[model samples]
Target chain A: MMSKIVRTMASFLILFVLIYGLYIIMHGHSTPGGGFQGGAVVASGVALLIVAFGSHSIHRSLLERRLSILISIGLLIFIGLAFGGMAKTFFYNFLVGSPIFGHIPPSGPNPGEMSSGGVIPIMDIGVGLNVAGGLSAILLVMALATTVMEVEE
Target chain B: MRKIAIAVSLSIFIGFLIATAFLIHPFGYPPSEMDDYIIENTQSETGANNAVTAVIFDYRGFDTLGEATILFTAVTGVVMLFRAKKKREK
Candidate 1:
């Protein structure tokens, strides 16, 4: 119906927003934003999407359950990466020329580029995912509770 | 009812803004120049080139741990507030 058209348009707009948000988050590591700022921007975009389109319209697409799982998974990955590094050389730049399991050297720039160098990029990705997942979990749980509240009345 | 709820929440949010304003000094503490040392050493020892990470996790570890505790508490509060909704629905 007409409502579906409106929702579909809104959905497309939200998708645009989310992509832009990711771009911002990715560049954020090197620029003004770090994990917290970039994460929050991406999270807010998700929240705005929820507001514009009903959960049923987008919930499955967002993978509510998987996102919750990913939240913990990201945390574990980050912590494991951290502690694992600690055990080796007391938190050595294990990600750098880390050789991807001691085989391949790190990404280019001859290992001299600070921003382009090792482990930092990996850490940024992990933090970005963690923020996105964590924020989504908060929204999911809140939404679940709110839906229940409506049912109770 | 929705309007009242919105108003109340807004007030609470505004109140927090006000409360925090007075908690810290406007003219902040002296520049410790402490971060400079951490930044230099972190590159060699910690291997973390990111200055913020070196300062937050390695140099000021105790504060970072405290922040983690704060995040835990905030999440716990949200869960508790919403917990009753599930039972009420059933």
Candidate 2:
């Protein structure tokens, strides 16, 4: 078992990391960070938690099965969004200037628009989910395998 | 003779590194006309304030798709490799 202080610090840090990552992903189309960076940050937070608490506790709480599902869902959302713009092109920017996420700004550096960038935000979300699940699964699988190997020995 | 050979190889490596450094363009001034075009047209085209994101998710979406495919494959491979452990645990 880990120390109480270590666990408490990890718990506190994880929340901030998650929120920052989500912010990066959400503001991807209007800021510096994008899906990959945000997802990596969030996955690192998960890694920190796992390291603090050990893999077994994490394994019981967050199943690999669920992560696989998340990866699949994220990929499906991306592909579906791509197909959504098939009427014009495969991955068309059809949503730009429409109601949804299609608010065109005045063609200069402005305040920022949440509902702009059309399909970019959706793609960012999909990619972010895919990366987070994939990376966390990799880390968990490695941890779980090592524990199993030790048990065998 | 061994020491001489190591010295020669190290000098050659250093020479190559120096040559590469000399060949590289000065910092902050990349000769990219495409960048100027993208910066100019990104707002109207994609409507996203961040041109980088616009390029990643819109202009070059195929690239993102390829990246997603690579991640999916990696995760699948890892899970498959560890499936035996899961079965054993069960």
Which candidate comes out best when scored by DockQ? 2
Q: Which numbered prediction scores highest in TM-score against the true structure?
A: 2
Model 2 TM-score is: 0.87
Candidate 1 lDDT over residue span A1-153, tens digit each: 136677677667767767766775555423445455566677777776666675545566885557656555555555555565575653344654454522222232224434432344454555666667667657856876675557669
Interface RMSD of 1: 5.9
Each model's lDDT: 0.57, 0.90
Q: What ranges in model 2 sit over 4 Å off?
A: A112-115, B1-21, B85-90
For each prediction in turn, the share of the native Cα contacts (below 8 Å between chains A and B) that it retains comes to: 0.09, 0.84
Write model 2 residue lDDT over A70-140, tens digit each, in one string: 89988998999999999999999889978866778887868734537888888899999999999999999
DockQ of 1: 0.15
- lDDT winner: 2
